[model samples]
Target chain A: MHNTLLTTHYPQLTTQQKNTMNKIQILVIGRDADILQAVVRLVNKNEHWNATGTSEDESAIELFHQHSYELVLLGGGIASDSELKLRKIFTLQNPDIKIIQHWGGGSGLLKNEIQSALENNEGGNFNIVDNPFN
Target chain B: MANTVLHKADTRGDANHGWLHSKHTFSFANYYNPERMHFGVLRVLNDDTVAGGKGFGTHPHDNMEIISIPLEGDLEHKDSMGNVAVIKNGEIQVMSAGTGIQHSEYNKSNNSTVKFLQIWVFPNKKNVTPRYDQIPLNLEDRKNKLQQILSPNPDDAGVWIHQNAWFHIANFDKGITTEYQFKAKGNGLYVFNLKGDLTVDGQLLNTRDGFGIWDTDKVQITAETDAEFLLMEVPMAM
Candidate 1:
């Protein structure tokens, strides 16, 4: 009854709004909460992309299973073991999923990396930045 | 229908960087083919020939299983883990960059090039610890039969990685035939022809060609001539 009531009360969505709802879902995994939030904000700047951020491996896995993510961005600061586990889990669930390792660069490099990964019609881990910190 | 894909020798991506001449069977650095990214968890298959006094500098990799099989000459390897070694034509080397590791490789000879295969496989387990292993293989064992070079089990035979995969190399005389059974139920097999002509199932492959097959229990391989090849069986779901 509650589900039916909520559904009946839902407002009609316009065609443009419905189209905007088809944003590509992405999962951002990092160890630092601040950086994770910042990366998520950068990812959300794209009109056609939506991102969820997590600072823990467990939460990342939970969110991954809860949503149909097309891409996963692994930010710096994640432990090597955690990064490997996340990669294994994500790939096992969706073999076609694209994963990119996000090293620190400004928002420009971040956007370029995300856009390139999404636009490239290939599947595999892409480590674009090679020691930007250096 | 059974799943199958083929890559002829000439169709592979070629990169001639003077000292380093390489051919990529799958998508690799500066060579991105969406349809040829990977077969199962086999990420990279690079046929590399490094000139004398040239090699890869110290670089870092994590959460990957990197394996190298020398085809000619000797490759000198030095890593941050304090492991310094040389892998020759009859030897294989594997590096488990679990957490993170920096390593460098160079051709040990000053007058000759070192030819080798650089393969990358996605590991099943996460960061355990970095490791390095290399072992000399008996070429006689592969005569007219498959010689195991790599596997998941540490005690089985050859070196081990953190994945449920098996690698074997064989040298068959003309008209030799064999049947290979899948070690795992949901695994796929990638065949790389090193020399001469061969046929897998019903597909013909020439030197330096690659063939991938899945969704089957076994495959029949027949050598059209004196041939050498590598068989890599990897999981399809991961």
Candidate 2:
């Protein structure tokens, strides 16, 4: 698997302001190729968000350690135990990062989840709740 | 005259990842065939069986009409729209990924496999607010006759999708004959035999066989044996 990154930049800003305007990074994890591609395309549509998806646990973990991601979207392809372990690792590394589990649905629900997560991050609130469906 | 094409069941791409077994009628995921990319507006037709207690995790879709028809066992569905339901054998589910949506499906049973057909069609109306609907299958009305299960009309008899396509399912006894005319002039029909044997437009089809026809008014189907099938009519010009 080659590393493919879709990056966005904003011009006409000061050096520090330009850094602040860099697109929000989102890490998506799932085993389904179609789902991964959809996530990347959906995240890139906003231009304010950049997403990278990988099915491999090691790859996702490595990516998390290498970059500062504001959120992580976990796909249903992973087991419950694995999801928890990954969530623990992600929060431990960055307390501000928001993680949400996605069961299959439509894009509207996905955007809502992302919005909720972003709001939680902005509020500086860190609370993990058990997903009733899980 | 109708332009006809036969897409045999065996020629479909197969993906088996232990917990899930899927067969794709058109290009999907890692399976890409340029010539077999789509059947007009019909983008994907995947026959899938998920292992008990396992399923697809949350996924995103937009600008597509997605449908699910369970053939065996039960499938648990959850979406970002706050819909959580179980679709069984006698039901049909549709989701319009208009602006965007996220959802997941898992087999609810721990001891049995859940088999279902997943379909995707390009929406004629784009970027509308996403919606979801599931309807109960009327088993009594479909015996030896075509039963309309999905259509573009919101007020129609069946569930509505965001595309100008129609879907019908039927269970025919042996020696039964039926005719299905296209609902729209420029639409093409994809006939998929779910079980038994049948003759469609003078072509014999066995279990899982698929036949696509366009440029015609109607197609004749004669059941050589007890047969169950799904018929989908979608626009060819989209």
Candidate 3:
């Protein structure tokens, strides 16, 4: 299912073609240590995505400065004010970076959010089979 | 001859990694005790507490019957089979990881911790299609009596699994007595005291204590103090 989605969305990057490209780096920032650990574990399952996570805001910023993250997933554990501040900082550092507020709904939602974010950022309108929220 | 074994609450291996604290009743992850490897077909019993908005990530499993019951707060479950749901207190979730499946669980609350029980039972039928089921429990039915929570028959009372076993839960008042009989031949009951005090077949048990009884048709439980417990009746020999 995941492979099919990627193949459909990115015609230029076929499943076979993906192996030659570098994996997209994802940064997961959260206040809860367990959630950070879980997100990293989930993200690493995908061959096209590499994940790094941190529970501290300062450490997350430091990691962001050191690495180019294609996406940033903010956990629900972060307060609204802090989330907004982080978003501002992220945008200033890399305006094209996709930052999503993750409700920690489940793996399915997380995958969808990542896909949609990537799709929108890349300006692709390829057909998506099921829009679960709709 | 009836045989019984006691597993004290303190004997279980403990693992605390900041955000996740878990107690393993049997060998799991990094904690391995050869003497406590398994009890019959029951391979794992874990008492876990996850900090708010934290939980287990997507992991693969095959040919195992996994059961999760939240004691407090809610848990969000997602699987590669495309099942997404929230299981809260008074609810039971079961997953048959046949032929391999990946799933993840997370605490749904951001402010409160979620405590839950994760149990694994060896499936009698292997290489079948993976399945997921969650059953909501009625609190009133379990008051002072055993409430059937899981059973072998798919059409039987409570949620069903791919095994000839039964699970029951009960909350008792002080001085109340209840008797549980084996539902199948050659079955043993693993009694776990969750809270308060109870005396089972002349043996006293405190919170978190586990007792396995086999070769007996019935076992009597007398609550010395208001108590709550779970009983799992599974085949003595796998």
- Arranged by TM-score, best first: 1, 2, 3
TM-score of 3: 0.65
Model 2 scores a TM of 0.68
- Name the runs in model 1 displaced over 4 angstroms: A1-72, A75-116, A120-122, A125-134
lDDT of each: 0.80, 0.79, 0.76
Question: Which residues of candidate 2, in runs, are more than 4 Å off?
Answer: A1-38, A41-134
For all candidates, state DockQ relative to the true structure.
Answer: 0.09, 0.07, 0.02
The TM-scores that each candidate's chain B achieves against the reference are 0.99, 0.99, 0.98
Model 3 lDDT tens row, B91-157: 9999886655678899999989999999988777655578999989999999999999999988877
Best by DockQ: 1
Which candidate number has the best TM-score? Answer: 1
Q: Can you tell me the CAPRI class of model 2?
A: incorrect
Q: What is the Å distance of residue A118 in model 1 from its true position?
A: 2.1
RMSD (CA, Å), candidate 3 to true, equals 16.9
Task: Give the alpha carbon lDDT tens digit for every residue of B33-91 in model 2.
Answer: 54565687787799999999999988776557889999999999999899999999989
Ranking by DockQ: 1, 2, 3
Off by over 4 Å in 3: A1-134
